[model samples]
Structure formats: structure tokens, C-alpha cells
Target: MKVLIADDHGIIRLGVSQIIKEIDPGSTIHEAEDFDETIRLLNAHIIDLLILDINIPGGNNFQMISTVKSKQPDIKVLVFSAFSEELYATRYFKAGADGYLQKDTSPVEVKSAVNTILSGKHYMSQNIREYFLQGMIRKEVNMNNPLAELSDRETEVARMLVMGISQTAIAEKLNLHTSTVGTHKYRIFEKLAVSNIAELIEKYRIYDYS
Candidate 1:
């Protein structure tokens, strides 16, 4: 098996590469520090599985996954993000990622998710699945998801804010301006009835922020 990992964080790349190598000792695992390098590498070689970060430089994880699938539908793509899957998984699946796992996920789960996705099966982590199910259950009974009222882009921005990332980082990750990110955050706060960052995240926590 050939594995390609794309994450700007050097430590993440080294650690995950170690895990992948340990899991499949004979496999060749390559690394790319950004989306551009990732695609550049992929265009030259067919990778069996891609472990991608959501906040890569050239593309947000969602767009990168779509680009990969649209160009090479056979490759398996799994998102490795610090952002919670509940807020992002549906968008990722819609964007054609094969699987989603949180950054804090254990190495065993990472290996299994990659293996399952490569085998042409869905790899929904138990925690992520629970998040999906909770979302479904909320929708089934007409419960209110305050965040649901926001646009997709706004929701993405809001969730990232609650995740405690800096605005500059969010701007960099989303390919938007610092001002634009601020506007989206303002709109998210308006929609969620939050007056400040503390309240915004606190309200998010009240909703069982899994």
C-alpha cells in the first residue's frame, strides 16, 4: 500500500507517518506539507490512500477532497482534522472524502479507517457516527439547531471559531481575508445570539457540542 500524508504541521506529518509505517511495515508512506505539494505529488504517482489535513494551503480540506475525487475517483481520501467531525463530516462526504477522523483519534483507529476506506467501505468513526446520528435525531423531531440557520460558509466559520483556532489561522485555512472572517464571525454571532466569543462557544457547548 502507498500512503501520502498532507499536513502543514511537521510534527503531525512525522507522527502520522510513523504510525502508518508501523501499521504497514512494507508500505511506502510519502509526505506533503501543503495542498499544492499534495496534488503535485499525486499527479506524478497514484497513491492508494491520502491522509489529508483540512487546513492545507492551496485548498480547504473539502475542496481538496473534491479535486482529488473528480480527477481520480479511485483514490481513497481521509480527512485528519482537529475540527470535530460532527460539524464537518457531512460537508466532507458531500465533497467526496472517503472518511473523516479527528486529530486526537488513536493510531489504531487511523489505521483501521484507512484500511476500511481503501477496501471500498465507509469508515465512519464511532464518535463521528454518533455525531451524525445526533444530528439526524435532532432533525427528525424538528429540534432547533441554531447553527443550522446559518449558511454553510458561515457555519464553517462559526464552528472553527468555537474550536479555538485563531482568526488569522481561520483566514489562512479558508482562503479568506481576516476582515471577511471577522464578518462571517459577526454574522454567526448574530444568528446564534452570541455577543462575544465566550458566549458563542458557550452556547455551542450547551447544544452538546460533540
Candidate 2:
């Protein structure tokens, strides 16, 4: 089997490569330190599986899944992220991930998830499964999700804020006035009912979904 490990951290790539080797001693493993490199490698190799990080450099969004699938429709993708499953796993699944595993997962479960996806099955934790069931039962928008209240632009600004980007920097990146970015930040905090970036991040982890 051929696998691509796409993450910015050298340590994480090394560790997961070791686990993949243990899972299949003859498996061919390739590593990418960023999303651009990942796409380049994908174009250069017939990868069977891609282990992806959500926050890899050059992209930190679900569209990355679409891009990957567009490049190689048959490749199975496993989202390996440090983000909370409740906030991100279902979204990744909806965006076309074969599986979602937290970075803190044990080596045994990592192997299990990888093997399961390799066999062409979806994988999710028991808790995520239960959450899906509960969501289906409710069958409604979660009104408590404050992040959902933000507009697309506001959400973009909020994410940058949570990432520690300055308002000026965000304005420059988004091509908006600094005052407009500050206004968006103020509105985001207000909508999320948070007083500061720390609170916004905490609320984000609790309520943010795709």
C-alpha cells in the first residue's frame, strides 16, 4: 500500500510513518510538510491513502478535501487533526473524509482507523457516532452554536483572530480596512458572546462546526 502523510510537523510525520511501517512493513510511505507539497506529491504518485492535517500550511479548511478528491478521486482520506471531534469530525466527513482521528489518539486506535479506512470503510469514534445519532434525532440547527451566527466574512475574521493574527494583518490579507476588520472582530465577539480572544477560542471549540 502507498500512503501520504501530510502534516507540517516533522515529529508527527516521523511518528505516524513509524506506525504505518509497523502496520504494513512493506507499505510505501511519503511525507509532505504542507498542502502545496501534498498536492504535488499526489500528482506525482498513485497514493492509495492520504493522512491529512487540518491546519497544514497553505490551507486550513474543508475545501482541501474537495481539492484532494478532485486530484485523485479514488484515494481514501483520513483527517488527522488536533481539533475536537465534536466540532470538526462530522464536518470533515461531510466534506468527504473517509475517517477523522484526533492527534492524541493512541497508536492502537490509529492503526485500527487506518486499517479500517484502507479496507474502504468509514471510521469514527463511539462518541462521534453517538453525537451523529443525537443530531439526527434533533434534526434541527443547533441554536446554541454561536459560531453559526456569524456571517461568512465574520467567520473568516473570527478564525484569523483566534489564530492570533492582528486586525491590521487580517485587513491586509482580506483586503479590508483596518477599521472594518476591527468592526468585524467586535461583531464576532458580540455574536459569540465572548469578551476576548481566549474566550472566543474556548467558545469556538465548543460551538464551531463547518
- Ten residues in a row with the worst lDDT in model 1? 136-145
Candidate 2 matches the true fold with a TM-score of 0.80
Show where candidate 2 strays beyond 4 Å: 136-145, 148-157, 166-187, 195-210
RMSD of each: 3.9, 3.7
TM-score of each: 0.75, 0.80
Q: List clashing residue pairs in candidate 2.
A: none
True-structure lDDT of candidate 1: 0.80
Could you tell me the TM-score of candidate 1?
0.75
**Per-model CA lDDT versus the true structure:** 0.80, 0.85
lDDT at residue 163 of model 1 (Cα atoms): 73
Q: Candidate 1 clashing pairs?
A: none
Task: Indicate which candidate wins on TM-score.
Answer: 2
Residue 149, candidate 1: how far off, in angstroms? 4.0
